[model samples]
Target: MFVIVGLGNPGKQYAGTRHNVGFDVIDYLSEKHNIPVNKVKFKGLIGEGFISNKKVLLVKPQTYMNLSGHSVLEIQNFYKLNPEQLIVIYDDIDVDLGKLRIRSKGSAGTHNGMRSIIYEIQSDQFPRVRIGIGKPQKGDLSNHVLSRFGKEDQEEMAITIGNAASAIETVVTEGVNAAMNKFNG
Candidate 1:
């Protein structure tokens, strides 16, 4: 089974914030695939189901962003899955808005959440789908990430979230390389 994790802070307050793009994509996937990601397990909300004939666990870590690795590590150990079976979706402030970057494996650059995951898991060989949120023009980093998108950006974000969901599907159905080739710009 493949474990697809979307990283974000939980709670209604974080909904629609740039940092919650991962959650938004997971929501899109849940709706599209009929997976009810409401069951609490492994420190996350998870739904066990099938995507393109592959058994999958859709996960939304509820431990917030910084502590995401704790939940992810638990799930990884319980399932006895290799790092390759794990796919993480999160926001990237370095890329342009509404864009995506898929990497087979890489060190976490500036994302604290990704850093935590890599540190706890002890591997950088997992697949990841990064939804670009773009850098803030001028503001506190936390404020920029926590803030909601503007009206125009919201429209772009809607499309990006949907695409991110589709990218996850492709990652499951095909492979990371295929998804990257198709989705990455």
Candidate 2:
């Protein structure tokens, strides 16, 4: 079994913000697989189903971005899963918008959500799928992540979300290496 977590702030105000891309991917996957993520557990919404014949628990941490680890730790402990069974999806400012970078394990860097998960779980040896949100051209970093995409980028954002969903399916069916080879570009 694998726990696929998408890091994002909860609430309607943050629904379409750049920081919520992780949630977006979770939503996309839920719909694609016909799994309803309506269960309130582990301080997050979760949907259990089989993806590519592998048992997967789709998670959206509701503890907001910075405190995401609390929720993740709960799920991890409940499932008795190893660090490698965790697959996190979140936004990254270091990469260009609409791009993806998959890693078997790595540091969180500037993402507070990832940091929280790593700190709480006591491990970073987990697969992560980072969707690029692009650095802010100017102004505060918080503002950039909290902001919604412009009309020009909406199309690209949609495509990226879809790709992220597919990439996750690939990860479950094949392996992290297969997913990285196919989606990380």
- Taking all chains together, each candidate's TM-score versus the true structure is 0.98, 0.99
Clashing pairs in 2: none
Q: Note the Cα lDDT for every prediction shown.
A: 0.93, 0.95
> Could you list the CA RMSD of all candidates, in the order they appear?
0.6, 0.6
> Candidate 2's residue-wise lDDT over 1-185, tens digit each?
98999999999999999999999999999998888999999999999998888999999999999999999999989989999899999999998999999999999999999999999999999999999999999999999999999999999999999999988988888889999999987
Q: Model 1: per-residue lDDT, tens digit, 1-185?
A: 89999999999999989999988888888888899999999999999888988999999999999989999999989999899999999999998999999999998889999999999999999999999998998989999999999998888899999989888999999999999999999
lDDT for residue 10 in candidate 1, whole number 0-100 = 95
In model 1, pairs of residues that clash are: none
Misplaced by over 4 Å in model 2 are: none
